[model samples]
Target chain A: MRVLGVDPGLTRCGLGVVDGAPGRPLRMAAVGVVRTAADDGVGARLVAIERGIEAWLDEHRPEAVAVERVFSQHNVRTVMGTAQASAVAILCASRRGLPVHLHTPSEVKAAVTGSGRADKAQVGAMVTRLLRLDAPPKPADAADALALAICHIWRGTATGRLQQAVAAHAHPRG
Target chain B: MRVLGVDPGLTRCGLGVVDGAPGRPLRMAAVGVVRTAADDGVGARLVAIERGIEAWLDEHRPEAVAVERVFSQHNVRTVMGTAQASAVAILCASRRGLPVHLHTPSEVKAAVTGSGRADKAQVGAMVTRLLRLDAPPKPADAADALALAICHIWRGTATGRLQQAVAAHAHPRG
Candidate 1:
């Protein structure tokens, strides 16, 4: 399955598409950052991010989209902006009828590096090795995005199947 | 000017449209809540909100859209949902090239009830009186939405003009 992961932010939104499944060789379809200036109005910045995500969705056409869930931060303003950007990414995917998954930072870290407390450098290095790339994706955000995609591919599919199993058990067909 | 105000929330997003200038009698054009099921996925909830906001914008065609600025709350999840919903409102307005304004709770309370710390009852009473409604809007969210629109009508226009003045002074055309 191809999954597009989004590291949502107001100033720089990271996006990466990965094609693969659990226990398989994963490949990077695309990776980039969508940047919005600090001076731009919040609405305008959101619009720009929306357009950028729309373009990526059109270009890569990933089967599922994974977005980083915005958790509470000390900086309320920053968290608000990040949450806003995250919502825009989810909206883009929903408009296209794509299933969207949200993964916490710790979840992505654990999935990629086998450690929830892994640092950025460790995660980046593991992503490079896993994708068999010469170097890690430029900008920490890009690497984080790739990690998210990988994590969702590894975890989301299993979770979906489990949910389906539960549903089927609850309402069995005759 | 006509303004559409949004009181962003996950379960019940309040939307209201009001028409008038700062000193004139304001008229209510529309008021309602966009409800989403709590059990729904976040992406589906956001998509529903987007569609609701789009419909409001298309029907009301307000000159500007006003959204409640999300404030830091003790409940992180609740705040995140509110911020996400607020972003959808802004995005809908931005897509339509309509100006978007964000008003704080204090700002709305002050504009509607003459006190920033006024309680919901006070604000609701003031909104009913200001809009000349037969009764206060059913839900508190709806009343808050109307208050936001009134606040923007009374304050946002003046703020916009002041911003224009500052910009023109910073960069003179001649």
Candidate 2:
């Protein structure tokens, strides 16, 4: 399956496309970032992101899209931006009738590195080795995006329990 | 000027439309909520919100849009959903090149009532009075959405200072 993974952020949204099956060798189709000026209004930045994501979707035409699930981190403000950016990516994919899936950071790390607690460098190294690239993708965010796609490819479809877990993460009453 | 106010949430997204200029009394164009099932995935929920907001835009043709600014509340999960839902609203409005503005909870309360710390009942009472409605809008979310539209009308365009405040709220380094 061809999958597009998006590591969403207001300032720099990472985009990566990958072609692979569960047991087949993976190929990197495209990888990049959608950046917005920090000084721009949230609305304007979101519009730019939408345009960028739409452009990538038009170009790659991936069968499925994977987005990094955002979590509440130490930085509350940054988390909000991440959530908003992820929303834009999800909106673009779902609007196109494409299947959208979200994988948590640890899930991606475990898929790539065999350890849920793997650090950035470890995940980056695994992604490079698995993709057979000259070097790891730049800006860490790009590598993370590829890892998300890879993770999604390995996991295949989300099960009912996984969907419930997602709901529980986003909804207090879930 | 007509304004569409969006009080964004995952479970129940409140949408309120108002028509008025600075000096004239405001008219209630429409008021409703776009309800989504909690069991649905976030992507599907976001798509539903985008469709609902787009339908409102098509039916009301508001000149501008106002969305309630999401803040870091005690419930982290709920906050993420709010930010995502609000982003969908902002995306829909800005994609159409409509002027989009963000109003904080206090700002909306202050615009409709005398103080920024006004509670829900107080704001609802003032909205009913300002809109000359026989009764206040049901559901606090709907009432708050109307208050947001009223706030944007009263505050006019987001000044340079206000935009900066918005940036500061959303971005960690801003």
Q: Provide the overall lDDT of each model, using Cα atoms, as 2-decimal numbers.
A: 0.93, 0.91
Q: What local lDDT does model 2 show for residue A104?
A: 93
State the lDDT at A53 in candidate 1. 96
Q: Number of the top candidate by TM-score? A: 1
Error of 1 at B173 (Å): 7.8
Interface RMSD values, listed in order for every candidate = 1.0, 1.1
Prediction RMSDs, each to the true structure? 1.7, 6.9
* Interface DockQ per candidate: 0.80, 0.56
lDDT of 2 by residue, A1-174 (tens): 899999999999999999998778999999999999999889899999999999999999999999998887548789889999999999999989899988999899999999999999999999999899999999888999999999998885546457778889899685
Q: For candidate 2, lDDT tens digit of each residue in B1-174?
A: 899999999999999999887778899999999999999988889999998999999999999999988887548789889999999999999989998988889889888897999989999999999999999898888998999998888786546458788889899685
Look at candidate 2 and tell me the lDDT of residue A8. 96
Pairs of residues clashing in candidate 2: none
